[model samples]
Target: MPATTIHFVRHGQVYNPEHVLYERLPGFHLSERGVRMAQATAQFVAENPATQSLAAIYSSPLDRTKETADIVCQAVNQARRVRQEKPLSVQFDQRLIEAGNNFRGKRIGRGDGALWRDGNWRLLTNLMKPSWGESYRSIASRMTDFTYEQVARYPGQQILVVSHESPIWTLRHLLETGRPEHNMFLRHAALASITSITFDSSTQKVLGITYADPAGGVQ
Candidate 1:
């Protein structure tokens, strides 16, 4: 835990640009829309100025997160007029995996048995503890701890953390100002969306969620 600004950015959209549920399926790359989204993320962070001062970048081992981190690093680097090699070394933190999905091996779509018009369908109830997957409590606790620990390593600072949707949303559920359990289904940390949090290093109590999706415009 540290008195630092933790910027948690969700990974870019997956190759499943069709908006299907993509989980546990490893090696999915950024789709064309995802690439453009990532670039928009880069430009937003680059032009924002406040985000150009990150000291370290950490990400999930997932390809989507890694790709997003790379582009963000370049944008921030270019913004700061940096002239050094390896401006930022991105580190992978596994605690950032997406909320375990039961539909991992299947192609999720309208025709798929798992795909649902309403995310809260009875089949998907208690998504955290999906009969097919992991618990919300587990994901939330681990991710919050990981984020707090990392923030401590760099106090009073800003760090970029590229992670998956569920993990990021879980963290948000724990730190955000809204209803506590809204994250189980409706929490949408879109592609390249950012959620910021701060907590006391000693007590580990979340001070608050400072800013979220500060630059993610429509869609």
Candidate 2:
């Protein structure tokens, strides 16, 4: 038995001039800068020796994630050869979708456009459990289950999962410290960032975790 690694990648920035929450919203594709960012991330992963052994790629079904996954799969196919003769294909996983939010299509801010102005006090009453959207525990549970499943299915290999910011960060926090409480303001998961998890192939136990911003400083 050999060790396995999984990389959780957050999608690039979207072309939202209004800065809408866009939670699970459709048709929100990547911006121009985002395209460059995704390409840079794919190239970074392709050139990195550690990720050369990636065997499979998985992504959320959202347009942004699908676009990023396509670019990454192409780069990995051209740069590295997996055990299979064909290039690694991108698979869709609903569990990797963005966290549900009631604030979708709304401009989120402390100004007048905020949710509070509309008298939606119920949504803001509980920040600990996050009354606005899906609970952190739910995201963590789903992501953890998906990760362990992939590890078990692909022992001795590496896999890449392209996902949204909330799910990626929540899963990272849970796997890293065994806590699911997440603070949106304290997020470290940059757009197009990669969070790596290492697992013991024999026991399917989590060994360690790491983080990287492949598109950093590439604005």
Candidate 3:
């Protein structure tokens, strides 16, 4: 069977000086180092034979993710131009958006106006299922839906996805463990990392999963 691979990338660091939970918030673009991180990943993808000819690019419609996607797209398209291949644009997908959170605009862990302060501490009832905001199942569901569609659309090919940490890791957790619930603090999807999952085109079964941290050394 032909195989299809999806490269899911978590966006780079955001320019959040306030350190508030910028979950699904506006005006959170990439920091300078974040741009460098994205550029590193972009160069890796453009030069890597396995991913240089990506079929499509999808991104969450958020400032940080879009910025990262834009940088990668530029590099990939420039490389494609050298080979006379048609350039691809970043396609925004709502399913790839950041997981919803109840702590938007609030800082967590200690100090004044923390998320745990006031009555918000009640939301910490469950960590596995993440009672604080959107459930892991929901995040995995949306990401899986998008993945399956792309798998069918670009059978035997590869694609790039720029999204937030929770959605990317949640889907991987579900695929690997047969469950979406996990410890939030133990996620492995680092900033600007790529989690590539290959699927059997006809069966949609995961054939293999690999991870690369091209921008890991940027920080």
Candidate 4:
């Protein structure tokens, strides 16, 4: 059995001037530069011979992720000669969504930390388990399950998934170290970055992992 690869793509920058911790808040779409970044990432992936065999594209239901997935699928279809009636067909999965945060609408700037000021200081007790919102272990479990399901369904083909930084990073940490705990301050996935995981088709075990920021130098 041949190995399968899945590319987890983090969405581009949001149009949040206030620097709000958007979290899973609705209506937070991509910014103008973000659109360009998504297009550039699509072009980079499409033109690369390694990703030419991508069979399916999946995305989170959020606006930013959907937009990014659309751009990527369009470019991939054009490059690979796969025709679709719509702009690009993408399957949305809730498991690929951003990590749920208790401070969704709050700004991340100074001011005694919104959560603490809001009397949510109790929620900060466990940073390792991340008592503020969804735990890292939960995020890792959901994402890993989704990835394994896709790997089983599409054996040797490459698959692309548009997701958020938290989930992707958490999943990456879990896969890399076989542990769910990680330092949230350390950023693993960048905006519009690609984290590729290759799995053995027979055992569904991870064979290798790679990271790339196709739109890193764009700005």
Candidate 5:
């Protein structure tokens, strides 16, 4: 059996601060710092061994992720840098979008979110049982399902996925231990963060975890 490698990245920060939430807003583009973060992340991928193995790149259809993917593609342009095949072209997919939330258009920093009475967004555990947003299980299911399906189809390919915070964290939880606690506590993936998971088609064991975030890593 062979192995499948995936490079999953969370989207950079959006330019909204006064908003209560931004569930699926179309115009929520990246902030200035976010641009730098994405640029650094792209550089990391560019110089890493994974770049040579990357068979495809997929991203959430949101503007932030789309833009991040574009910048990263530039870094992976070995066609210009090392005279390899054409540069990477990210394939946008709606299924990679964050799990649906009631915060569709609500401002995030107004008064208080249902779970976060202090204005900030709620933690995953606190938000887990509330109807204020989508359930953790629902998000976990979607991300993992799509990931597994992608791996099965691509076989030994290395892939990259650009998506949002929650969805990316949920996928990491599923990949790491597949335990309930990882979802509830251990998974705290950040904006513009990169998390890698490898699956051996040979032994069927999901091996290793290599995570990094140039902008404040995991804080």
Candidate 6:
């Protein structure tokens, strides 16, 4: 049976100075180092045989994700141009967005306007089900929906998807462990990393999962 692979990429570091929880917030873009990280990953994708001939490219609607996806898409297209292949553009999808959080736009430190202040600590009850803005199950459900749709759309091919850490990891955890609930602090999805999942094109059964971090050493 033919195989299909979906490479899920986590967006690079943001330009947040105050260290606020910028979850799902607009106006947050990638940092200077983040651009280099994305460039490294783009180059990796462009040179890697498994991903160079990507059938499609997708990204979360957030600014950070869009920026990273644009960089990768440009690199992929440049490589495709050399082979005289049709170029692919980055398609935005809301399902690939960052996990919702009640702490958005708030710092996680002590004192005024902090996440722990003004009885906000009550939301820290459970990290598994996560008593926060969005449950892990919800994030995984949306991500799974998106992944299955793409798998069917581009059978026997490989595609790239740029998404946030939570959604990507949550879906992976759900598929691999049969549970989406996990400790948020221990997520394996790193910045500018690629988590690829392969499936049987005809049966849609998961074949395997792999990971790579091209920008792991980037400062």
- Per-candidate Cα lDDT values, in order, are 0.71, 0.87, 0.93, 0.87, 0.73, 0.93
RMSD of each: 4.0, 2.2, 1.1, 2.4, 3.9, 0.8
The TM-score leader among the candidates is 6
What TM-score should be assigned to candidate 4?
Answer: 0.92
lDDT of candidate 2 over 96-171, digit per residue (tens): 9999988887776677676566876667867657898899999999988898899889989999999988888888
lDDT of 5 by residue, 120-159 (tens): 3544335444345676677777777777877787787788
Flag clash pairs in model 2: none
Which 10 successive residues of model 3 have the least lDDT summed? 107-116
Cα lDDT for residue 28, candidate 1: 87
Worst 10 residues of 6 by lDDT: 104-113
TM-score of each: 0.80, 0.92, 0.97, 0.92, 0.82, 0.98
Candidate 2 structure lDDT? 0.87
- Candidate 4 residue 161 C-alpha distance from true site, Å: 0.4
Candidate scoring better on TM-score of 4 and 5: 4
What clash count goes with each model? Answer: 2, 0, 0, 0, 8, 0
Worst 10 residues of 1 by lDDT: 176-185
Report the C-alpha lDDT of model 4 over 45-163, residue by residue, as the tens digit.
88887775687899999999999999898898787664443334799999999998887777766675454467666677877888889989899999989999998998988999999
lDDT of 3 by residue, 118-193 (tens): 8998988999879889999889899999999999999999999999889999999999999999998999999999
> Which pairs clash in model 1?
1-201, 128-136
| Candidate 5 residue pairs in backbone clash | 19-107, 19-108, 19-109, 20-107, 20-108, 20-109, 21-107, 21-108
